[model samples]
Target: MYQPLAYRLRPKTLEDIVGQEHLVGPGKIIRRMVEANLLSSMILYGPPGTGKTSIASAIAGSTSFAFRMLNAATDTKKDLQIVAEEAKMSGTVILLLDEVHRLDKTKQDFLLPHLENGRIILIGATTENPYISINPAIRSRTQIFEVHPLTPEAIEMALDRALTAKDGFKDEDVILEQSAKRELAFVTNGDLRSALNALELAVRSTPKNEDGTILITKEIIQECTQQKGFSHDKNGDAHYDVISAFQKSIRGSDADAALHYLARLIEAGDLISICRRLLVIGYEDIGLANPAAASRTLDAVLAAERLGLPEARIPLSVAVLDLCLSPKSNSAYQSLDRALQDVKNGKATTIPNHLKDSHYKGAAALGRGLTYQYPHEFSDGWVAQQYLPDPLAHTRYYEPKFTGRYEQALAKRYEELHQKKSSSTK
Candidate 1:
């Protein structure tokens, strides 16, 4: 049976692991543990292909502990029992639990005692944030370490090693171009497993030249990965991640990063998501700080909608650039939210009697509008009167921001009105 290149290239020792220098580098925590031959239960969380499993395997390999792999979601309690039995017989078994965030209460209970006793050194792996997804009982017992995506330089280094490694194309005559290596390294977006697999596929599928050497080109790498990083999966976790990055980039005023994520969304054909998020960012982030820019954002979104697709990206790009460069303020929505929270808490809801409708005949009998003072009838077209209910007569909301000239002017008028209201009440 032929093993996959990634499987064949699994890191057999801590020294062999690539990337994640923070955890695996010299003088790092994991490296120190391995050097001292003291292994503890750990949860390694990160995106897939970032070497969570590889790190687990390397730990077991280095420590000389019995290694076993199982899926927390698919495996039953009986499967865990088997590992427990093996730990009894072998003294200690290093169990690499995949998708550990899905471990149910029953399995977690069964595994806890074993982890405590050190009979089974648990190396839980997950692609989700363990703090949010994993049960607290299990979390409290294990040391959680985060794994990050491998850098392009790290991937390139791995590709270079794979070219000459015994299990790779060392036996066969193959020549890999520098451009091809860089393309393979980059197109996978820091996914070393994907890069290795794509490299293997390219090497195997291409025919040998007259000199009997398989020459791999950048085009070959792209063909192998089928557009790789350029193509976005709209239904995957990466989709939401990209959307989050898109909005945050704009909010942070990083125009380049915003455009990069926007381009990804565009390529994925997620015009609806792109347009909706842009509209939200315009108001929620730009708000009173740059009202005109917010209005222009809506206009750009409308243009994009009418244009649709390839042409739509043009207008969307212009809108994203504007929003990123515009002054940001969330005060408008934040003030509304503060008022909403008061209402939800049952702080105040009744309208003042004076402000109530009095156009109806029976309203006067109910004392509605009895003390009403119409602002239009006043000389200054303004009057200070109780607008809030008795319980919240002095309640104030709508705190204007001063991040831009527009909001600064609004803030000035707001203070003036507040002062007039305060003096009249006195």
Candidate 2:
């Protein structure tokens, strides 16, 4: 059976792994474990194509242990039993369990005792957070290490190696242009497997030149990657991460960074998410400080909805730029949160009698609106009177933040009313 370039080029030792120096580098915990021949069951969590399986295979190779592969979601208990039997025969085995978070009770029970006795060194690999997704029983039995996405530099190094490695296209006259290599590395977004797959596709599909060399160019890579440069999986962790970065970039007042994230979301065709998050950022991050910017954000969102994608990005970009440059303040919502907390805590919450409705004849008889003072009846359209419940009459919640001209005026009016109330009380 023909193997993929990625599978064929799998690193056989810790030293040969492309990224994850913290785990596979010299003197690291994993490298140390292999060096001492004292292996243990561990879970490796990270985004796909970041060397989790490679690490498992390398460990098995380095230790000369029996290596077996199985998918926790798809493999049956019988398959696990086969590995267990092999472990008993060989004394030990390194098992790479993919999507280990999906391990069912049946398979887990069968594997537990083997793991405990060190008969099978379990290397559980997952793209999900082990703490949140894996069972506590399994989690407690293994040390968890996070694998990070490979950096562009690390991916470039891997691409360079693949062009000449024996298991790669070394024998073929595959002339990968420097720019093409960078493009492949850039488009894959730190996924070495994706880069290798694209590289293989480009090499096989492109016709050879007169000199008998398969010339891979930037155009060829772009075609092979199919505009995967801004690939986004809407149901994956990266979706939330990108949205978080998008909002944070706007909150940090970095228009360039905000637009970059916006572009990624645009490529994903996620106009609704873009609109929703921008609307939230307007109120949550830029409230009161630049209310006009918030209003314009709404307008841009409306325009985006009317126009749909491609052109929608224009209004979205305008809104993002406006928000990124707006004066930021969360005090408006923060004050409401304080008041909400008081309500949730069940603090004294009876409505003051004077502030209650007095429109009905029976309301006056019930002591409603008896001492109420209408602010509009005063000369300045303002008056000092109790509005809060008795227990919270003196409590303060709306602490104004004067981050912009508009909020500065609001703060002035707020202080004026506070002073008048104090004087009235005296």
Candidate 3:
């Protein structure tokens, strides 16, 4: 009759909840919603151990509405119909559906009508992105509340509760060293349930001395949790951690590290996510400086999707190599940042009249194209004229890097223009 430590230590109230104070604390959105009984259909989106289910349960238990629970992984349309029928009789039913994204389009459509009629207040829990997984119609009817992963501090608090809770380790004479507790927390990676489970196993495995005391040291916790298998399944912290490491490696220009992380994801059956991320990085990070990088990434995505794993490794390797070998530039990224900063500082410059559109009537009379020089009409396909707005005419925002095949020509053209302008000024 040994119950799981996570179950025994589950928070029973909002006050008992270990983390996410931002949402559940005083004056927060969720708090206001709960207190005011403005329980609209909502989607609680977050990774595991972020207390999605706990929040739903706390709200349902505290509210006046009748509550019902269902899991999309196992629940069927028939189950939903039964719940819908009961909800109609109850006036306002809070339907707590776990893994709501697991419901197919047909099943999700079944709830749309009832949701629209205000018969059921759907509180959904999904670890996946609602944009891709949840039906658009169903998602439209619900307010999306994002719940982030529990922080290390939050996980530590949960561990403390588990060690001392009556139903958890009250009967055991176990003491965990501070170092051992930190190690468990780190290994859990902000996963409260996993942390508690590791702590329970560590305590259980520790041998009691003849002195009648059991000690959980760093070594013991490490040993117990080290053997635990890690997965790259979409729902868990490992998924985010691996992808984060991969992105950081690319950003840092560590080709070897990027490849290693890519291999890890591939081995864990996360090929699709890996492919998708590569495509995103191509545009978001490796853009313009090396245009070929984006094209290569897109090709890899198509290859991975078409061929599937093992075989897909070929294209994955190609994409990673291209990203690693491509000349790095954050100029595009920096330009956007600079533009936003300019706007924030009230530096909106006026457009030069010469560069303004001259196709419209009265544009020529207003001196729109009076001094405008067409670059294509010049011998070198370059013209020395003011391109920037009047206020920012002397400001230079784009400074091309002298790296990569495409950017080398860009760098040369920029230098030539600068020389020409400097000579003319003298």
Q: Can you write out model 1's per-residue Cα lDDT over 26-87, one digit (the tens) per residue?
A: 99999998899888899998777889999998998898789999999999999999999999
**Against the correct fold, how does model 3 do in TM-score?**
0.65
Among these predictions, the greatest TM-score belongs to: 1
Q: Is candidate 2 or 3 superior in TM-score?
A: 2
For all the candidates, what are their Cα RMSDs to the real structure? 3.5, 3.6, 9.0
Count of clashing pairs, candidate 1: 0
30: Cα error in model 1, Å: 2.1
Candidate 1 local lDDT, residue 30 = 95
TM-score on alpha carbons, each prediction: 0.84, 0.84, 0.65
Q: Pick the candidate with the highest lDDT.
A: 2
Instruction: Give the better candidate number (2 or 3) by lDDT.
Output: 2
Candidates in order have lDDT scores of: 0.91, 0.92, 0.81
Off by over 4 Å in 3: 227-231, 234-426
